[model samples]
Target: MLRHEFQPGRLVAGLVFAAAGTVYAGDAAGLWDTPWFVIVPLVVGGLCLAGATATVTRGIRRRSGKKRLGRSTLDG
Candidate 1:
């Protein structure tokens, strides 16, 4: 039913970057002023968060995979 694996970490990272782009776009459109230094921390913090999320997700998937395999073996 799925074409590819869904990665939440990538999704979060993409949303963060999209937010940063939107901020700049708004500033360009005269909606608000964004400080030049704002993107630095935003991107860095987002990347860190994404990395952590990826780690957690990978751990979860691995554990679930092992459990599923174990159950299938027992059932068979």
Candidate 2:
């Protein structure tokens, strides 16, 4: 069930965070510098936050059965 429960958006956001962390660590070595270095993490972090927020909201809605597509068998 974990596989079915997994959210694609969350996965993407996590990957973005992971990439940002990796880039930050690599740049910390001082081998290279770029103006976009600072901007990248902010953007990635924002995306992660947004994705997580959406995922949580969706989960809440689903748990409440507020977005079901059809009637239950008991209705019949």
Please report the candidate that would top lDDT against the real structure: 1
Q: Which stretches of candidate 1 lie over 4 Å from their true place?
A: none
lDDT of each: 0.96, 0.69
Best by TM-score: 1
Error of 2 at 12 (Å): 0.7
When superposed on Cα atoms, how far off is each prediction in RMSD? 1.5, 4.9
TM-scores for the candidates: 0.91, 0.45
Model 1 / residue 17 / CA error / Å: 0.6
The TM-score between candidate 2 and the true structure equals: 0.45
lDDT of 2 by residue, 44-66 (tens): 67697768777886888687784
